[model samples]
Target chain A: MVTVTKPLSSTDSPYQSRGLLSTLRRSPLTLLTHLSVIVIVVMWTLPTAGLLISSLRDKEQLAVSGWWTSLSPSTQRLMVRSVPPDAQLEEGGRYVLRGKVSDDQALQVLAFGWSSREPAAYAVGDVAQMRKGQTLSISSNGEYELSSPEPFSGARGKRLFYTAKIPPRFGLDNYREVLTTGGIGQSFINSLTVTIPATVIPILIAAFAAYALSWMAMPGRGLLIALIVGLLVVPLQMSLIPLLRMYNQIGSTFGVDAKSYLGIWLAHTGFGLPLAIYLLRNYIANLPKEIIESARVDGANDFEIFTRIILPLSFPALASFAIFQFLWVWNDLLVATVFLGTGEQQMVLTARLREMLGSYGGNWEVLTASAFVSMAVPLLVFFSLQRYLVRGLLSGSVK
Target chain B: MTHLLSSLVIMLLGVAACGFYFVFSNWLLLRIFPVRRVSLQQQAVNIQRAALIRPWLFLAPALGFLGLYLVYPVVESVRLSLFDRGGDAFVGVANYRWLFASEEFQESLLNNLLWLLVVPACSTFLGLVIAAMTDKVRWGNIAKSLVFMPMAISFIGASIIWKFIYEYRGEGSEQIGLLNAVVEYLGGTAQPWITLHFWNNLFLMVILVWIQTGFAMVILSAALRGIPEETVEAAVLDGANGVQIFFKIMIPQIWSTIAVVWTTITITVLKVFDIVLAMTNGQWKTQVLANMMYDWMFRGGGDFGRGAAIAVIIMVAVIPVMIWNIRQANAQMEGR
Candidate 1:
C-alpha cells in the first residue's frame, strides 16, 4: 500500500539539485503556470466582481457603461437648455446669456456647440461664431456663455449641446432602492426565517439519528445506512409533486394555508436529513469508542452520554453540517419556489431575486444590487467559515 | 415586521419542542422502568430492554421526516404519474405515453442529455486542471478561494451575473455587457446569446460549470494532495515531464476521486432549474427536465400527473448513481 506523506515541495525535488541551468530551463514553464493560474482566477472572479461593482455604480452610468469602465471618466454628450432670454443681462454692451450646462461640478466640458449638427464643433473655451453675430463659448467646467451684439430674441432658452467627461460615480443608491422599493429587504428577512429553523432543526434531529445509527447495536443498521446513502441521490424532483398534493390535502383538512413557513421548514429538514445523517454518522462513527464506553461505565445513560460527550466532541462535524445546511437553504430556489408562498412577506431572497430577474430583466442596477443582497449572507458565511465548509465537503464526499 | 417576528417566535418554539421531546422521552423511559426501584436482578433486564427502545426514540423524528418528505413522496409520485392531470382518476400508462410522445418532452430530454454530457465533463476537467495547477503555486489558497466563491452564490444570482455579461445592444450603440463589449471590440457583431437555438443550451451549461468547477476543485485537490510522495518522486526520477507526470501519475492515482466529483456534478446538472428559469425559462430550445418539471407543476393552474411523470423521469435517470453510491457506502461500512 502507498503511504501518504507530506506533498513534495518543488524546491526539495531532485531535479532542482542539477544546478541553475535546469532551473533556468524550467522557469518558462513556471511562468506559464503562474500566468495561466492568474488568468483562471480573474476569469472565475470577474463576473461576481462585476455584479458588486455595478451595484454600487450610479444608476445612470451603470445603465450606460460596463462595470469595468466604471473606474475611468466616461465621455457623455449632453444637452441642456440655457435660461430663457428674459434672464440674459447686458454686460460690456453685449446682451449675454450665461448658465452652467450641468449641475454636476465634476463634469468637464471637452467641446461645445449651439446646434445639434455640430455638437462638438468647438474646443473648450473656444468662441464659436453663431447666427446673427452671436458668439458662444463653453469652459471646461461646464459654464457656457452666448453673447450677441444685438439683444437675444428667442422667448425659449437656446438648446446648447456639449461633450463632457463624466467622472465615475459610485454610491449605495441601487442597494438602497432595491432594499426598500424593490422588496429585497422583506425577502432578506424571509430568507432568514426559512433558513434558521430549517438549518437548526435538522441538525438536532439528524444528530440523534446519526448517533443512534453509529453506536447503537441495532438490527437493520446496515440496511438503514445504505437506504440513507441511496436517498442521498434521490432527485428532489420526485418529492415536489406528491408532497404538494399532500400539503394541499392536509391544509384543506385542517383549514390552514397550503403554503406556510412551517411546511417549507419541514420540507427542507426532510430533504436535508439524509445528507445530514450521512455526514454526522461518518463523523460520529469514527470518534474513538473509548469515551462513550467510559461514560456508560460511569452509569450515564445513552442520552446523557450523547448530550455530554458526543455532541461536544462532534463540534467540527456539527459546524460543517450547519454551514452546508445554511448555504443550501439560503441558496435554494427550487425548494423555496415550490414550498413557500410567493407573497411579498413570504418570498425568500432567491425567489425574490428570480422575480426581479423577470420583472426587472433589463434593469441591471436593480438586478445587480438585488443579486448581491441575496448573495451577501452566504458569501459571508462561506468566507468566514470556509475552513469548516471545505472540511465538510471533503468528509461528505471523499471518504 | 410583525409577521417576521411571529415566525421567529414560532421557530424558537419548534426548536424548544424538539429539545423537549428528547429530554422528555428519555426521562419518561427511565421513570417507567426505574433502575433504582426494581430488584437488582430485574434492573439488569430493564436496562437491556430500555437500550433496545432507546435507539428508536433517537431515530423517531428523523425517520418521520425521511418518510414524509422523501420516501413517501417518491412512492406517491409514481402513483400520481399513473393518474390523470388532477390525480382524480386512474389512467394507467397514459401520462407515460403522453410523456413519450410529446414534442416538449423530447426537447427537454435532448437538452438534459446535452447538459448531462457537457456540464459534468467540463466542470470536472476544469476543476482537475485548476486543482493540479494551484497546488504548485504559493498563492494557491487565495486563487482557489476565488474560484470556489461562486459556489456560494445562488444559481439565480449567477444567471443574473452571466445575463449582464451576455447583454446585447443594437448596432451603432455602445455595448455594456462584457461579452458583447469584447465581441464589439474585436470587430464582431454582438448577438443575443440566450435566444440562439441549440447554442443557448451550451450558454446555460456554462453557468453550472462555473459554479460546480469550484466544488470539483476542492474535492480533487484533496485527492491530489493525498497522492504518496514516493510515487511522484519515482516519476520525477524517471524523467517524466510535468504534463506526463500529471496525466500518467497524478490522475491515475486520483481516479476514484475524479469519479466522485464527476458523478456529484452529474447529479447537480440533472437538477439544474433556476439557471434555465431565470436565464431563458427554457425558451429557444434550452428546455431541461428539471425546469420542464417545474413548469408542468404549475402551468395552466396545475397538472399533477404530467408533473409527477417528469419528476419520475428525472428520478429514473438518477437510479444508477444511487445504486453506485449505496454499494460504495456498504463497502466502506463493511471495511470498518
Candidate 2:
C-alpha cells in the first residue's frame, strides 16, 4: 500500500498536531484566549445590537429605559389622576373614586404614593393617608381606589404616583413611523437609485479597461497601471472643489440643473474607477495564461475571449468589486452631500440621517430607526456576500 | 412613487448607454479595419493598426472620467487656492496665511494629529491581538464576524450607535445611556462624554477604532495564517512561550501586512468626516480637517479659496502614502 503524507502549514488545524493540542489543553492560556475573545466580540457587537433592539422597542419605553433592559420588564414611575367630586359615588356610606392607574392591563404596580417626592413610598395594596380625610390604595394590577369618610369635594382629581413594572414591548412601529413620517423611505429609494447605476457602470467600464491593461499588449500599460495605483490614494477632498465648479459652469453653459442624478452618477463612476480597475486588473492579469493563449490559438479575438471566457471566469472578482462599490455608494455621505443636492427629493439616506441627527438629536426612537434603515441594506449585503468582501479586501490591499 | 420611477428609468438608460458604447465602438472598429477579408498584406497591416487602436477604444471612457473627475480637480483646486473666494481673483497664498493664523484651523490640526496617532495604533494593536487569539479558538469565525460587523455600518450609522452608548441624562434622572448607566452603577456620576474638551476627541476616536479594528483583524488574521508552520514548530521546539513566539517569530513575518493595514486605516483616519459631522459637527473641539474643509466649502456662502487650500493640505499629507503605495505596487509587479 502506498502512503501519502501532506505537509502541515500554519493554517492546518491545531488538532492535527497532537503535541500542540496537548500543550494547549495543559495550559490555562487557551481558556484566557477564549474568554478574552468572547469579551471582545461582545464589546464589538453590543452597540449595533443595542441600536437594533432600541429601534424595535416602544418609543416611550425607548426614551425612558436603556436598551439593555429591553428584553425584561422595566420598572417605570408613573402618575394617574383620581376622579373628582362629580364622579364620586357613595359606597358603604363613603365617597369612593375608583379607576385603573394605567390603561395597560399587563402593568404591575409595585408601589404607590400621593407625592412625587416619594413616588414609591408605599407597597402595592397599602392604604396611604391623604391631605383630606381620604385614603388611597393601589393593587398590583394597576387598579386604584380612593375613599373619603364625609365626601370628596374638589374641582380637579388628586394626583397619585406609582411605580409599575411594564412588560417588554417590541414592534416595528419605529420603522413604520420613520419610513412614513421621517422620510427615510424616500431616502432609501434614493440610496438604491444612486448605488445600482454607480456600481454597474463602473464595473463595465473598469472590466474593459482591466482586460486591455492585462492582455492587450498596449503601450504605456505599466505607466497606466502605476497611475491607477497612485490614484487609489488620492483624497476625494481633492476632487470636490473643482468638480463643483465644473458642474456649475456646465450647468450655466447648458442651462441645466447643477445637481442631477446624472451628474452624481458620473462623479461616482469617476471616483470609483481607480480602485475598480486596479482590483479587476490584479484579478484578470493573474488568470491563467494558457486559457487566453489557447483561445487566441482558436482564432478568438480579444473581445470575444474577454466577453465569453474572461468575464465569466472573473465572476468572483466582479462580485467582490460590485459589493465594495455598492456599499461605498450606498453608505456614502460625503460624495452624496457634495455632488447631489440636499433637497427632500435628492437627499440620500446618509444625508437624511445626518439632517435628522441635527433636527431630532434627542429623538433616539427616530434616530435609531433611521440609522438602521440606512444600515439595513449594507448589513444585508455584508452578511450575505461577506466571503467575497473578505476576498476582495485580501486581493486589493494584501499583495 | 414618480420619483422612484424616474430614477429607475435614468439608471436603466445610463447602464444601457454604457453597454451600447462598448459594443458599438468595438463593432465600428472591426468594420473599419475589416481584418477578416482583404489582401494578405493589407489584412496584416490592418490587424496591427486595429490592435493599436482597439485598446484605446477600451480605455478612452475610463480615462476621460478619471481625468475630468480626479486629475483636473486636483490642478483646479490648487489654482482655486491661489484665487479669492469667488475663484476669480488671484490672491497668492493669502488663504494659506489665513489658515495658519486661524485658531479653528490650529485646533482642527491638533485634533487630527491626535486622531491619527491614536486610532490607527489602537485599531491595529487590538486587531493583531484579537487575530492572534481568535486563531486558536473553535468558534473563531463567528467571533470574527461579530467583531467585523461594524465595518458594514456607515460612519454616520456608527456615530449614532456610539452616541447612544455615550448618551447623558441630568444628575437626578435615570441614565439611559449605557456608559452613564455603568458609571452610576459603579458609584460614579454620569457626565456628557462627547462634550468634554480634549477627552471628547478620544470619545470620537473610539467609534472609529471600533469600526476599523475589524478591518485590521481580518487582514492581519489572513497574514498570520500565511506564516509557515515549520517556523512555528521551530519556535515551539526552542521552548519559546506564546508571547515570545507572537512577538519574536510571528510578528516579524507579518510586519509588512501590519504596515499595509496601518496605512490604510491611517488614510481613512485622515479623511474621516461623517462621524464628527454627525456626532458633534466640530463642536467642542472635535473638528477634523475633512469636516473643516467641508465647513469652509459652504459655511457662509462658501470660501472656495480656503476650502481648496485645506484640501491641498490634505492632499499633501496623503502624497507620502500615495508614493509608498505606488512603490509597493511596482515592487510587487516586478517580483511577480
Candidate 3:
C-alpha cells in the first residue's frame, strides 16, 4: 500500500501551545469573520435605526436633510415679518418697524445668502441697504459691505439667517398614522387573505401532484412533468386577458363577477402552481425510494404513504416552498389590480406601499416605518422557517 | 353490479391519487398516437364498457379543470398572440416582426441575456464561496440564515429594502437612501445609483443575487457536507493544504452539485420580473422580457400576440437549461 507522508516538520503543536480563546483571537479569518458579522448587522439595522429616528423627530427636520444631520440643529434663513407689512409704529425720529429675529447657540447662524441655493456666505444679523439709482450698500455683522452706484431694495427683502435648535423626540405616531390613516391595516388583512389561500392551495394541490408524479405508478407521468416544466416560463401577463374572460364566463355561470378576492386568489394559485409543482415534485421525487417502498410494503396505500411518511420527511421542502409562495402572493399588486379591487377593501400591502411611495416618499419616517411594516411578515416567516432552508431536502434520495 | 361497484372503487381511488394520467393516457392516445385498433378489436376491448366509463369518471374533473384553466387558455393565448387586443383582425405575425424590429424590445432581450448570464453566475459564485467559508464555523448557520433572509422576502419587499438603499435625491438635498446616507457621511454627494442606466440594472441585479445567494449556499453547503471527510483527511496526509485540497479535490468532487445549484438559480433569474418592476418601474432603460410583455399586452399597444411571442421566446430560452437540469437530476437520482 502506498501511504501518504506527513509534512510540517519541526513545528510545535499550536493547539497545545495556545488556548482556544487565544487561538481564536489570533486567527485572522475568525477575526475578520466576526468583524464582518458586526458590520453586516449594523448595516442591516442602521437605516431602520435612522428611519425610526427620523420618523420620531419633527417632520420639518426630516425634510431639510438626512436624519443623521438631526444630530445638530438645522439652520434656515428667513425674512420674518418685522411688524408685518401693514404694522406701523412711530418711535423717535420717524416710524420704526421693529421685530427681533435672532439665531444663536451651538446652532448659531453662520451665514445667510439671498437665495435658498446659497443660504450661506453672509453671516447672521447682516443688513443690506439699497436705493435704486443712488447707492446700494450691504453690511454683515462682521462689517463686510457691498456698495454700488445704485440703491438696492435697500430691499431685495432682508435675508435673515438663524439656526434653530432641534431636539430629538420619539413617538409611535408614524406607525399609528400608517395603521389608521394610510389604510395599511386593512391592506395588511387583504394581503394575508390573498397570500394564505394562494400559498396553501398550491402546496396542497401540488403536493398531491408531486406524490403521484414522483411515486405513484402512472402512465404519461414524464409528459405531464415536461408539460408543467414548460409552463414554468409562460409569463402570467400572457394569460391575464384570457383568464379574465374565463373568470367572467365562469363567474356569470355561477353569479360571480369580474373582480373579487376569489378571482385574485385563483389567479395567484394558477400562477404559483407551475413552480410549486416543479419544486415539490423535485423534492418528493428525490426522497428515498426505499423508505417509500418500505411504507408500501407495510400496507400503507399512496394517501397514507404521503400523509404519515412523506409529509414529515418533506417538511423542510414544503416549508421552503411555502415561504416562497407566501412571499410572492403577499407582494403581488398586478393580479390584484386586474382581478380584485381598486377599493379600500381590495388593496394589498404592496399596492398600499406603492401609493405611500408616490405620496409620502419624502417623509423618511413614514416611508421607513411603512416599508418595515410591509417587510415584517416576510422577515418573520423567513427567520422562523429558515432552518429547513439549509437542509438538503433532496439528499440521499436521488443519484 | 359487483363489477360496477369494484370499478367505481378504482375510479374513486384514481381520483384520490390526482393523477388522471393513469386513466386518461390510455384514452388520449387512441387517436393522437393511434395504437393498433385491430389488435384491440381482436382482444375485444369495448369502448362502451364500464371500464371505460370508470376511467372517464376519475379523469373528468381534472381534465375539465386543466382544459378550462391550463390548456384552453394556452390555446387562446396563442390565438390572441396572433391578433390585436380586441381580436378584431389578423395581424399575421406583425407584432412579432414589429417587436423584432424595435430597438426597445431588442434592448429588453439583451437585458434578459445579461440577467441570464450575470445574476446566476454571480449569485452562485458568491453563495458557493459563502457556503464554503462558513461550513465549518460555529456560527456558520447563523451567518447563512442572515444572508438567506433576503430569499424569503418577497421580491417587492427586497425591492423596497434595496430601494431605500438606492434612494436618490437631487443635488443639495439629503439622500434618503441608506447608501446615500453613508456616502454623504463620508463626504460624498448622493448619487442616483439606480438611475445610472446599465449600472442601475446591475444594482437591481444585486437584489436577485442577494435573494439567491442564500439558496446557493444552502444547496452548496449540503454538497460540501456530503464531501467525504476521509477523502479530505487523506488529502491532508498527502501534504495538501486548504487551498490545494479545495481546488484539486473538493471542487472536482462537488462539481455536479455546483452545476445543479447554478442551473436552479439560473432558471429563477430568467423569471425575475417583479424586482425590476417594483424598483425602477423598468424606466431609465431597464426593461426585461416579462415587464415588456406586461407593458405591451396590458398597458401600451395591447399587443397580445407579441406578448405571447416574447413568452415563447422565454420558454425557448429555457428549454436547454431544463434539459440540463433533468439530466443532472436523473444522474443524482441514480447515484443514490
Candidate 4:
C-alpha cells in the first residue's frame, strides 16, 4: 500500500501541472471575461477616439467619408472643365487643348472619361477616343490634352470627368477655424473666468465652514451639518429662477448688468457650497482629535490651531475639493446659461458648445474641434489629478 | 485676453477678501479676548467668548453663501411657483394644476421617470460588472481609468460625441455615424436613432449611463477591494465556487456601497438637461423634468411660475434620497 501511494503521488505531480495548463487554455469563463472587458473598453473609448480623430480630419473628408476612413485616400468622382475653346491652339498637326483638370495639385487624377455616364472608364495616362475623331489624354498629375481632327470650337471647353485619389490630409485647421471664427476662443476664456473664482472662493468659504462645523463647539452645528447634507442633492434648477430675479433686482438697483461675471461667480460659489462644506467637514472632522486637543491644551486658540495645523493637515481634502469644484464649475452648462448672459461676451464654453449644437449641428468638424477644445482643460485636470478626484469621490459619497 | 486677466484679478481679490475676513475677525476676537496677559478669571471668560464667537466667524461666509444660495432659493422657488409668469401676481397652485393638465409636462414626467429608472440602474450595473471583472487582472487600473475618463467630459461635449455617433444620411449614402455604420455593416437599414419616440429617451439616457458608469465603477471597485479576504476563504472552504463567492460573499459585503453609487447616479439623472437640450431639445417626445424647467424658464418671454413648479417637482423627487443620505451620514457619525 505504501509503494502504490508513492507511485500515485509521483504520477499525480506531472498530471497536475498538465491539468493546470489545460484548464488555463480551456477556461471559457476567463476568455469570455476578457472579451467582454475588451468590448466594453472599446465601446467606452470609441466615442472620444472618434471625436479626436474626426477633429483632425480634413473638413471635406470629414463631411463625406467616415472618420474610420480618414487615413486612406478617399475616392471621389469629379467634373472639371478643360481649357475654354479660346485656349485651344494647333499643336504639331492636330488642334490641341491642354490644361490641368484640377489646379489644386492635391488631387491625383486616377481615371478620366469623356462622358458623364462612365467618368472613370479610362485609366489615367490612357488616350480615350471621343465621338468626332477626338482623343483625350489625362495624366496622374491631372494635366490633360484634348486633340481633335477638327478645331475645338465652342463657347465652353469640353466637360471632362475624372476620379481623383485625394490624399489623407490632417491638420490643426479645424481648431484654428473654430477658435478664430467659431467664437469658442472667447468662450474658453469665459469658462476660465467663471471657473477660477468659483473654484477658489468656495474652497476658502467652505474650508472655514468645514473647520467650524467639524472642530468648533458651535450651537446648532448638528443642524447645519444635516442641512448641508440635505442641500447636497438640491437640483440647481431650484435655484435659477430665484437667483436670476435676485441678480436682476440687484443689477437694476445698482444699474449694472444682471449677468455680469461677478453675479455668475457668486452663483457658482453659492451652488457649489453644500458639497464643498460637506466633503471638507467630513475630512476635517476625521483628523486625529489628539492633534487638535494637544494644540488646544498648549494654549493655541482655535484660530491658531486651525491655521497653523488643521489647514496644512487637510491638504489632500482641500486638493480633492478643489479639483471637484474646478471640474464642476468648468463643466457646468445649466448654471452658466441661466446666470451668465447668452451674449458672445459672457457665454461659457459649455454654453458655446450648446449654441453651436443648434447652429453648427451639421458641421461635425467644427463641432468635434470645438468640443475637444472645451474638454481639453478638464481632461488635463482629470488625468493629472485623477487620484485626488477619486479620493474626493470616495470620501464625499460613501462616507 | 483682458477678460482673462480681469477674471484672474477678481479671483485673487475674492481669495484676499476671504482671507482678510478670517484673519481680521480672528484678530479682533483675540484682541478683545486678550488670552496672553490677562487675569486668570478674565482669560477664562475671554476664551469662552472667543470660542463662541470664532465658530460663527469661521462659519459666517459659508453660512451666508449657503443661506443666500441654497436655503433661500428653495424657499423662494416654492413661493415663485405660486406666482404668475411675471412673478408679480399670486397664482396659487394654478401652475401646478396646469402642470398636471399639460401633455408636455406629462411627457416630461414620464421621460424623467424612464431616465431615473434606467440611467442609474444601468450605470450601477455596468459599473458593478466592470469593477468585479477588472479585479484580479493585470491591466485593471488602465481599464478602469478608460471607463472613468468619460466622467471628465462635459455633458454638452458628450452630446456632440453621441450626436455624431447617431448622425444619419439618406439611404445608400455611406453611413458616417458609428451606430448607423454598424447597422449597415450588419445588413440592417440605417435608422435615425434620436428621432424615434420611445427609444430616443433611451438614447439620451445612454449618454448619462456612459458618463456615470465609471463613477459607479470607481466607488464600487473600492468597496469590492474592501471585502475581507477571510470571507472568501471561509466560503471557499465550504466548497463554494467563484460564482457563489461573488454572489453570496462579495455582493452582500458591498451592498451599501452599491446603494451609495445608485443613489448618487439617481440624483444626477434627476438633473438631466444638457444631453436632452443638445440632442433633440425636447423634440421627438424626449423631454425630461430638468430640460422642461429650462424650456419653461425661457419659452416665450418665460413662465417663472410653471418653471419653478417643475423645479419644485424635481426637488420633491430628491427629498427621499436626501433623507436617506442624511440618515446614512448620521449613522456613520455615530459610528465615529
**Model with the higher lDDT, candidate 2 or 3:** 2
RMSD of each: 3.3, 3.4, 10.3, 6.8
lDDT of 3 by residue, A227-314 (tens): 6665655556556667866676788898966688667756776777766676777777768778988987785545567668876877
Go through the candidates in order and give each one's C-alpha lDDT: 0.89, 0.89, 0.63, 0.88
TM-scores for every candidate against the unseen true structure: 0.93, 0.95, 0.75, 0.94
* Fnat for every candidate: 0.73, 0.70, 0.20, 0.76
Which model is ahead, 2 or 4, in terms of DockQ?
Answer: 2
Model 4, span B41-76: residue lDDT tens: 998898888888889999899889989998999999
C-alpha lDDT of candidate 2 relative to the true structure: 0.89
Give the distance in Å from residue A3's predicted Cα in candidate 3 to where it truly belongs: 37
Predictions' DockQ, in order: 0.61, 0.61, 0.17, 0.56
DockQ computed for model 1 against the true two-chain complex using alpha carbons? 0.61
Model 1 chain A, poorest ten-residue lDDT window?
Answer: A1-10
What is the C-alpha lDDT profile of model 1 across B1-336, one tens digit per residue?
776776678778877888999999998898877789789998998898889999999999999999999999999999999999999999999999999999999999999999999999999999999988887666678899999999999898899999999998777778889999998889889899889898888989999999999999998888887889899889999999989999999999989889889888889889989999999998899989999999999999899999999999999999988888888788878887
